[model samples]
Target chain A: MSARRGKLWSRTVFLLILVTVAGVVLLPILYFLTISFASNYEAYQFPAKILPTFSYPARLRYNADTENYTLLLKKGADFEAVKTTSDASDFSLYCKSQLNVLISPPAVQTLFDRAKASDQAVPIKLRKDFFRNYVVFFILAEGTMRALFNSLKAAGWTILISLVLGGVTGYILARYKFRFSTTFSTSLLVVRMFPAVALSLPLVVYIMRMNLYDTPFALAIVYSVPNIALTAWITSSIFKGISVELEEAAMVFGATRLKTLRTITLPLAFPAIVASSLYAFLAAWNDSITALIMTNDNPTLALLVYRTVGSSTIPNLPAAGAVVLLIPSLVFTFIIKNYINQLWGKVAL
Target chain B: MSYLKLSSLKKTYPNGVTAVKDIDLEIEKGEFVVLLGPSGCGKTTTLRMLAGLEEVTEGSIVLDGKDITHLPPRQRDISMIFQSYAVWPHMTVAENIAYPLKLRKMDKRAIASKVEEVAKICKIVDYLDRYPAQLSGGQRQRVAVARALAVNSKLSLMDEPLSNLDAKLRVSVRTFLKEIHRNTGATTIFVTHDQAEAMALADRIVVMNEGRVEQVGSTREIYNECGSLFTAQFMGTPPANIQKVALASSRGRLVAAAGGGEGAMPLDLGDRSAFPGMEGLIGNEVFLAVRPENIAIGEPDGVNEASIEIVEPQGAYTILVTRVLGGEWKIMLEGDVDFRIGQKVSLKIDPGKVMFYDAQSTKRISLS
Candidate 1:
């Protein structure tokens, strides 16, 4: 009975830890999503909302003694007078700027006349266009779509270059023994020790000399420098796990060396290769400092999103941009998740 | 001309260690030859050289009248079954069998038919669409065999393929492999450390020690007529009993005396005429090897007397262990004969089957 109670206690503690970890990771993402859908006015509201709402309940009243119209917004159960305006254009501009609720001057004037006629307080429902922030970010922000394309191209080239060069180096390291092989493998890790930001500065000179500056290809070259080492380190262990006899079997059964590599070694190492490609993709897609130093006219989406954070006082626009930047990484990870599962399953065997 | 010939083949690693030293062999067409030795005895190295997986450091390999000493494995037109089976995990069983045929540029229809044929032979037809990961180890081994068979290459090489299976599975697979070889008639070179496996499967066994071949002959010849002390100690379940003793004539009968001085006892080895040319080496020390089955236990003969120390019943036969020449010696008797420990018995060794070896060189000495 004591053992059973102890097990139950441990299970409860484990569940608590799991929930805490999930909240810590997911709450920030949830907040970011809500802010991306928020209006400029909702962005500054105190005690921020966890979820976005489509419509706000409020009342419009005419104050005959003050000779002005008053807007009362519902906060919880009570209403509070938020703004007062007599001019139609002023009311229209206030709704558009503060409320993110579009109202034409003529429409505001009609509402004002109706409120003036009715001595009682008039109920009004203010509706907001939910996806306005996202639409405006793409349509109004210059070079945003181009930045998305640049990030994609850079990541693609990085995957291709890193897989081709690192995979061969990894296979050679795993399969062969030579003088100073340990030293050579250790030296690859040494290359990864230098910060990518430090290397990007010197690489820009070569990029300019080669006339490839401000291009996604130049960004790929810088990203691949560190990613190649990481890919080699990851793939070498996986290649070692694959038996050499498998490759030799292919060769003995009429396959040439290159054919053996293509058929046997690469397929066996594919899950690791896909995993390394994900590392390479994230390195190129999420890197902003390197892009800041290496690129000027052609910026990656991550760089654009970073610039958006500094320029905007309201967080909604930049949050929308960040959400846009998150999409490709999520899709890439989702697609290769099955392959990673296979890697784990194979290891268990 | 032989179907395959390796002339003075040698292998020396870059680390200054020689794995194979001056191996010369000729193989006839359709012969199943087994290279048998313990681990690190260069048997696998010799097989790898034949498969072109290892570079021949010194000599030439002529296959079907063509010099292929430096050629790569693919150019050699051979198929090998690895000890690990080495079946591709990603491919289905059918694809694994069809890959080599496809590489040889066979048409799709022919490849499919060939795959079905070999899969039927290997008893893996029911698992044609299943991947290797889904198959058991024994089934994967069959897939590997089927893959090698589908190629129908000039030569087939197996490197300890049965060592990975369980004991019972190993015996069944051994019979299955022998049956396949009989039906296929492909010239095969099999490498293994199991003496029984080699004896069971080989048309001829090449027994190796260290880096060179000790002897190469049929199973019966290797067992009954060992050319070297290594082969005699190597090719049996219980192994031959060998002892160093001095040869002397006792009353005109050849006798081997063990345990020098007054404590020495003479093992009467029948008439002097049985071993010709025995007079020259009188009183000289030589190694005497006697098979356990050849040593008969009987009433006290007043010549070679010993007390039984232990008895082991193996269902089919019984082994009696006794002290002889200051060492434990085993004797085999049929049908679990009642022999109790500490029982006094006399041992009579068969004179015609007795073998003598030169103590210095460890080589067999022919007396007839």
Candidate 2:
């Protein structure tokens, strides 16, 4: 074959391989979203609907007497029988239903009611679409988002604290020779392998005694503990590869130890510190079990997602929340993909 | 007054290897001294001790009238260019040259001017902004020189600094270093195993051997009148040849063999009363030490004959190896004197150039 033909053939094969691999990876995600939005009736039908062809209708009870349903506090004993008993004279129940159940937060619920009452009481067709599921998913997602925000807040603090502490500890371990330097270095790894969950009960009791339970501060400390050894070992190895001669050269030029570290040694080590911080961030972000065990009232997204998953009789909404949960981590990993490769190369044995 | 002096220096490692054993040498100001020896000869150790990099196990190192053995390397005002050219790889040539001045807290403007001045002298001005990894080997060596010079220290210690370069570059750098030493007039202590470098660059060469000083003298003095057998063997390219010869008394006078088979030839001993120690024995053994270059092919009045065994034609001179009586010997012939192999050729060894040593002790004896 001619060289041009040969080149064209090879490129076509390469692109075909890439596209096929991408299609395989992306297919399951596309399939899950398609089925999640399909009507529940259609989903359970003889042959499952791969696409939404028709909308399903849902039924809700309204009182003919009061013409309103109370949203909160149905007197505990009448909680299950609240499907009836609405009377037109009970304006408080009507206002409560209008504000709490029929409308959402961060906006005037009355405006939505006005928009609804000015139109039909059916309100946007009452069709059994993904919005009903989305409405529930959004609430859970907000809790998840708060949990996400809390985890991010805790992780941001963890990475910052770990980088400073871990960098100093690593430099001392790698460069200086003290009487017990080896013993000190070995203990870092020992602390990392300590089972965190084994200490969780005691930690929770301690946090409660300190009045730190359900706070992001306590969760951040828990997350930072596991990262100390990992950051130390990784940063120490990088510091070891940097020749002490370079630092001494700076010292000869009148730089003190700290000055030398700031000017010469730290610049060379910046990439490694960044890599370690990313690792610490991911560790804190993905730690669900610790966050769940440590917190109660101010639960993170992982805890909220768990609560949503646990309470659901059916798994569809939770599965939808799970799909949403994976998005931020995916986007974060994609954005820092190059740094991940570099950090991996630096830390890998 | 000497700029640097080492007073009875001693260095012993932790495991008890005495690298430099009681060495004493004084270097005058502006003088270039080279410590030359084979590996493990303690030359490098002594230089390090002087540079304040290595600790002195015993004795004091005084530089410019101040005792500095206990001082650190940076405080001693001594600059050292390592064998590996210890240039910081991350820094540019300008930055490296400016480093010492920066250490002294010199003003930025002055440091820049000094760096430019030294860079121009080393002819690396154009390469100032480039990092060390970008420069050629010769350029890096020049940068190392510039960095050392920028400090303007009292003493400069160079440890085989040009050993890494190619031969042509080595010669150029060697010449440049000599010129720099002369212009700056800094007391320099260079260490090298290359004899040619020591011979070319030193004002006084201190020959070391196995942790002790073998000889210390000018280049000509060491070559002409070597104090030990090691010095004589080490200084020359082909080295001096030593052979055992039977000295016999003729007419109650002692003389060594003059190269005829089995007592047929004899050398005249001028005085009988002299060398009275030979009275008890008419025959004894002695060592004849002569350099290869001192021996010639043809007879020159007081000469001997030996059968040529092999002839080697080097570019400047031809060396003939010949067997005389019981043993083989070598002689250097002037120019391209192509004497055929296995030819019985007349050879001349100038008696004045030959040295005498005791056969058993290998110690120099009374020449008369």
Candidate 3:
């Protein structure tokens, strides 16, 4: 009975810890998603909403003594007079900028005349266009689609370059026992230790001399510098776990060394290769400073999103951009998760 | 010309350690030859050199009239089963067998048929579609065998293929491999450290020690007529009982005396005429080796009297342990012969079966 109770106590503690960790990770993303869907007015709401709001109950009233129109917004059960405007255009502008509720000046003037003639408060019913922030971000932002394409191209090239060069280096390091192999392997880590920013300045000059400046390929070249070393480090250990006799068996069975690598070694090391590609992709996809120095007219989406955050005080536009930036990374990670699981020995290939 | 010939095969690593030193062997076609040795005896190195997996440092290998000393493994028509049973984990059993055929540019239909044929022979046909990781170690070993057999190469090499299996599985696989060899009739060179596996499988066994071949012969010759002290000591379970003794003639018979003093009692070894040309060296010290089964236990009379120290019943045969010539010696008696500990017994050394070697050189001495 004591053992059972102890087991139950441990399970309860484990569950509490699991929930805390999940909330810590997921709650911020949920709040960010709500902000991405929020309007300019909703962005400034106090105590900020964790869930998106679509519509608000409001009332427009004409004050007789002040000779102005008052906008009353619903706050819980009661109405709060948030703003007052004297003229029709002023009221229209206020609603458009602060409330993010579109109202033409002529329509506002008619409503104001009706409110003044009748001594009663007029009810104003408004529904929010929830996807308006996302639509406006894409429409107003310059070269957003082009930046998205450039980010993809850069990440694609990074994966290609790193996997090809690093995979061959990994195979050689795992198989051969030449002189200074340990020294060579340790030096690859030293190369990774140097920050990519330190290399970007000198690399830009060479990139320009080759007439490849401001291109996604130039950015990929910078991204692949640190990524190749990282990829080689990861893949070499995994390749070591693979048996060398498997390759020798292939060779002894009348397959050439190249053919053996293609049919045997590469397939056996595929999960690690896929995992390395994910690292290479994220490095190129999420980098801003390296792309900042390496590109000019052709900035990647991450750099574009970073620039958007600086230009806007209201975060809705930039939040929308960040969500858009997150989709591809999420998709790639989801696809590569199975391969990573295989690397951890969860599934046999 | 021999089907496969290795002339002066020597392997010296880059660090200047020699694994195989000047090995010369010739194997005829359709013969199953086993290289038997302890670990680091260079048997695997010799097999690897023949398979073109290792570089031939100061040697030449000629296989079926082709000088394939430096050719890569693919260019040489040979198939090898690794000790780890390296059936490709990424491939299904059928794909593993078909891959070599595909590399040879055989048609897809022919490759499929050949895979089916070998899979049936190896009894892995039911698991043709299953990956190697899904199969047990023994089944994966059969997949490796099927893959090697699928190519129908000029030669087949197995490097301790059955070493990874359980003991019972090892014996069954040994018989299965021998049966496969008989059916296929491919010239095979198998490397193993197990003497029983070698004896059970090989048409001729090449016993190796250190980096050189100690002796090569049929099982009976290697067992009863070992050419060197190393072969005699290395070839048997419980091994041969060896002692350093001086031969002396006593009572019109030849005897081997063990210690130097008054306490020394000579073990009787039959007539002097049996050991021709050994009469001149009667007083010279020589090494005497006797198999456990060769020495007979009888009623104590006075010659080579010793007390039985232990008795071990092994289901079919009983091993009786006693002291002979001041060294612990084992005697194999058939079928549970009851013997008590500390009981006095007489040990009769078989004169014809007793082997002698020069103490300095450790080489066998001819008696007749």
DockQ score, prediction 1: 0.58
Top candidate when judged by lDDT against the true structure: 1
Model 2 CA deviation exceeding 4 Å by range: A1-266, A269-281, A289-349, B242-289, B299-314, B317-347, B355-368
Identify the runs in model 3 with alpha carbons over 4 angstroms from their true place.
A62-69, A83-96, A100-125, A343-349, B259-264
Question: What is residue B131's positional error in candidate 3, in angstroms?
Answer: 1.1
Cα lDDT of model 2 by residue, B269-301, tens digit: 334465544554346666666788887666434
User: In model 2, what is the error at residue A248, expressed in angstroms?
Assistant: 4.8
Instruction: Provide i-RMS per model in Å.
Output: 2.7, 6.5, 3.0
| Per-model root-mean-square deviation over C-alphas | 2.2, 9.3, 2.5
Q: Compute the lDDT for candidate 2.
A: 0.71
DockQ of each: 0.58, 0.13, 0.58
Better of 1 and 2 by TM-score: 1
lDDT of 1 by residue, A130-239 (tens): 88787778865688889999999999999999998888888889988988998998899888889988899989999999999999999999999988888888899899
Q: Residues A1-349, candidate 2: write the lDDT tens digits.
A: 6999999999999999999999898777776665555434334444554454433232223433555432222222332222333333343333233211232232323433443354332322222334445466777556656777886787788888788888888888898787889998898888788777865667888888899898878887777776777788888988997777566555544456677788678766766786788788777766677878898767766666677878865555665666666677667667666653442113321
Ranking by DockQ: 3, 1, 2
Best candidate according to TM-score: 1
> Which pairs of residues collide in model 1?
none
